[model samples]
Target: MAFDATRAGADATELDVLIVGAGLSGVDAAYRLQTECPDKCYAIVEARDAIGGTWDLFRYPGIRSDSDMSTLGFPFEPWDSDVSIADGDTIRQYIQNTAAKYGIDEQIRFGHRVTDANWNSEQACWFVTCQTAAGEQLFRCRFLHVCSGYYNYEAGYTPAFANRDAFGGEIIHPQHWPENLDVAGKRVVVIGSGATAITLIPSLVKDGAQVTMLQRSPTYVVNLPRRDAIAGKLRQVLPKRVAGSVTRWKNILLSMYFYQYARRKPDSTREKILHFARQQLGDAVDADVHFSPSYKPWDQRMCIAPNGDLFRALRKGRASIVTDHIEGFEAEGVRTRSGELLEADIIVTATGLNLQLFGGAELRLDGQPVDTGKRLIYKGMMLDGVPNMAFAFGYTNASWTLKCDLTAQYVCRLLQRMDKRGEAVCIPERHEGVEADDMVDLDSGYIQRAKGFLPQQGTKAPWRVHQNYVMDLAVTRFTKLDDGTMRFQAAPSRSASPTQTATQAA
Candidate 1:
């Protein structure tokens, strides 16, 4: 039931829920909302012309997930395929299929970009304004769920090259991959060593391009096959719940182990990681020029996928890694700090995305600017003073969908509680001492670069994002829905408990 955007007409449409961004988060939100509250009216407003937000946007040579499909994918819907790490196309199809199966496809309006949303304190609704291909449209909804994601819709990241304009080679960003661009038999230099750069290198190599990864620093590189043979075997006989739990634990423990190893024994961890990378790359390649990094393990992000595709590509001589800081861009190549000019016909900047709070839009409460920097994130979902609004941001280290699932479940519980109490809104208050800007703990390049643009964490419960799934389960899933902070004024009989202000309690 695909939505016929042109046929919807220009009438002011109202819904119970107005979701921004038809990406993974938004799609998941719709699914959860529809499944739990079947009678609720909801519409997904996508800025893009199609569904699949990041998957559709990123069309680089080898775009794929960093985590295993079993964990990275949605919780309710299982990826019933042989490939553990799925490509963008497959992932897109899965989302589309999920939307269709849940009867949510018709709910999405393509080319509908949200311009602004002003919370009406008196009306108790969000007045959303948007620009669509049809015309200017307005949507009024009780809940404004933002799933636009942190990354900029346009070109994500740009490297600081002294002579970017002077570079005669075709410059390209992974986000805006050219449609007519051909890299076959061309010397390709990919800058940045994040997921995109590593993923691109392996695929470009197969496409007959001599790929060289120009990375300023190194990341802890590890390999697993595309499929867990042990897990696959167990899944054949066991139920989905048991199998998923087992696989989840396996990945969780491995991730925790590596995270701990990188933190506690960085030197040994670096030696082991580099040694494995060298072994994978083989002796024919120059290990000194490529595998070494200036920083310790986990100082930057680590890239991993099943089957060692990137490393294998390097071993086959189809690709090479160059660890050097780019001094500037020359007419035909990039000049490194070591006084070496690496010639390239094509340059791909996989420098990552620019982080934005609430999808880079300034939130307004009753026509006044809501500073997210000053506010505290409540349970990684709601913001203080903002009623009936919740956002879902996945974990950086582990599978994204895992955290999203928890957030969704928590949101559902909150919604159910609100409904039971006959409450029109649910606003979690922010506590004091947690308003400081420097609470988040991740040190990724993107996080460091755009720390000011992101939201800060609270010192106490609900505000802190403990990456441990078990602990998060207790806080997000099993926690009591009736927290004293949430007010239900619409109810005839108000609770007798003393109400605490946003500053007094969390």
Candidate 2:
């Protein structure tokens, strides 16, 4: 169990658990592993040089968490800020600070991109291949925890439009925003009506840019204050942790109720949301054309505007929304299908994200490849038939961390139970006759685009990923480890060390 550099090449390292990614989920997983499974050896492998996955990567005009920080933050670490909706930089700092506080930063291997992970039934371990600075490196671990988010980091989703080459203006995507590009006093057209577009419009307008959010269809937009007065008052009287817990549960219940209400009463929910948008925009913007989406509520993610910033921008004539289809790109700007030319000095494509699973790493069981799309998810964490592996995927309906925190806790409990039972391999087996469903039930553009590649869910417990956080919390946090689905076994006798084989190759 000690560092096995003697067997694998001197450069190779062996661990009890290998966590991929050093983002919020990864860091949270590390903290749980260190706390709950203190005897195990673990390391966090991050593709980027720095921590904070999505928060650190996005550096557009305005980047912030759509969900409140209380629920988004780890349950162990209480977010003490008065601002419920936190900015990107603050969130990034908080993640880094958490790592530092828990001594997790040292365990992170920066620039170690996991290219492939192969499970060896003979050794009961995962031989991970990583692309590092020198070349390909190897990491051997008993368990592989994938905390990498569900998006492609290399690029955002940008569709090819006709005559794109004719556009002479500067074009950019918020995912890869140029540091030196100037947008002051310029005409900017931000395409898409999702969260990125909502955040960017206000930020660009504040920076003196005449911004226009050009969307092909309408999306639900709701306004919330920047600071939560109730949270602030609770903090004044109650302890920080207690107040945080209260606020967290409050947000959780409210979100669950709203989502349920939206689903059960779609017409009323849509009307209420549109009414709020109309109040914010006044008579300046047409609510029916710009804010009323054709789909039912919760069909796609509802955009949250802090302090009514997006509406304020529109009211002040700093920003505007245009709902139309794009005909093509012209020399100066984009031409609409309605024959109106949108003059722009810079074009921002805030389309959507390209979804990726397990950081797009190739997975193989023994020598055979494992197709995740065909596999059933076990408790929303482990895939059926995948041994000693767990993925930290959060809720689509509620705050992401709520589910992730429970997943981390559940994994820790699993590792402990495995150790106690002297189990080397634990694989979730799919029972017969279970109905298969989409990995995520959401109809978002990104989710739909990657539906064919994602893992399938089931109709019953253990296999079903109930998007409800409360149900997930009860199941993931308190469920017995020896559930009928998860099968455990001892390690197979090996002739040679797996580490040595990998090291020699390295």
**Judged by lDDT against the true structure, how good is candidate 1?**
0.75
Total backbone collisions for each predicted model: 4, 1
TM-score of each candidate?
A: 0.90, 0.95
Candidate 1, superposed: residue stretches over 4 Å from native: 1-12, 239-246, 286-289, 435-439, 491-506
Q: Cα lDDT for residue 442, model 2?
A: 81
RMSD of each: 6.7, 3.7
Query: How does residue 171 of candidate 2 score in lDDT?
Result: 90
Which 10-residue window in model 2 sums to the lowest lDDT? 1-10
- For candidate 2, list the clashing residue pairs, or say none: 9-503
Model 2: residues >4 Å from true position, as ranges? 1-11, 494-506
Q: In candidate 1, which residue pairs clash?
A: 224-307, 225-306, 225-307, 226-307
Question: On a 0 to 1 TM-score scale, where does candidate 2 land against the true structure?
Answer: 0.95
Question: Against the unseen true structure, what C-alpha lDDT does each candidate score?
Answer: 0.75, 0.88
